[model samples]
Target: MQLLFGIPTNKYSSLIPTTFPENVSQLMKVFFCLHYSYKYNYFSISCWQSLPYNRPTFCELYEQINKIIEIMIYIIWNQMKKVILHWDKEIRDCERVMLELTIAQNNQRLELEK
Candidate 1:
């Protein structure tokens, strides 16, 4: 899953690092982009869809804001990249545990049937 402006989505909300960005202006920038993306294309990100905003006249404003601050996005992207890596590892570990549980359950069922 992916958020607006290409932020990858995680299965759990707690895994998302930038849910509450430190800077309010930057947060608004993100929100603006999200709104724009939601309007123009398919936005299936369940968590982000919950934001309360109606799109009317934010596209031009967002473009202006984005033009002034490309570097800020780079900084935020780097921070989110680290978090994403960590979450990926955690997700992999959880998947492994789930696979093991399924195998054990199957084995137990086989033994019971025998």
Candidate 2:
């Protein structure tokens, strides 16, 4: 998810879902900002624009950002180890539909070959 969100969206509204717990939401925002700047080459411009406010710019917030990233990684790793998981059935259903389509195509191919 972190890796994929860097791509430009067709519309600005195509953001990651914000339905997670508050802590997770905040962590995701920080992670997104970090990943976006790194992947898209916008760090300097982002930092400069944010300077007018007292907010910590990317460079200045390096250590704290890294700490947050580490915390997020630790939380996810622990959950994975415990087999704690959440499944989005909509995505699973989409996968099932694609698989059914592939099988149908293969069956059609076999019939035509016969």
Candidate 3:
């Protein structure tokens, strides 16, 4: 399972390191643009679908909030990158865990769609 995270791996860390201000700003701009695009797309669709005149019921609202919390927690978790220098067995176990999670999510989504 490939991870989406921040810290560079140890061996070739300095290979991509940059100390330029312009490079930093460029990276920030790209990140913000991608962020805004995703945010605005979700908000625009959900906002129109959930107008107050035809607002969601209490249970629906509760479900929506729970979904938001789940997404936030997932994003927060992926932002953390812990460099673990462990045995091959431990790394394999972690990969298996991540694979199981991905499969579970896909199965759940399929069930919902059906």
Per-model TM-score, in order, reads 0.40, 0.28, 0.29
The better-scoring model by TM-score among 1 and 3 is: 1
Candidate 2, 11: how far from true, in Å?
A: 24
Return whichever of 2 and 3 wins on TM-score: 3
- lDDT per residue for candidate 1 within 41-112, as digits (tens), equals 222223334332422235644664464357568778999999999999999999999999999999999999
Which pairs in model 1 have colliding backbones? none
Candidate 3's residue-wise lDDT over 1-114, tens digit each? 011122222222121235436875454344334453575334323422323444345676567557555766776666542324345568899999999999999999999999
Root-mean-square deviation of every model: 19.2, 17.9, 24.6
lDDT of each: 0.55, 0.55, 0.50
Ranking of all candidate structures by their TM-score, best first:
1, 3, 2
Q: Point out where model 1 deviates above 4 Å.
A: 1-68
TM-score, structure 3 vs. true:
0.29
Which residue pairs in candidate 2 collide?
A: none
Candidate 3 error regions (>4 Å): 1-53, 82-114
Model 1 deviation from the true structure expressed as Cα RMSD, one decimal place: 19.2
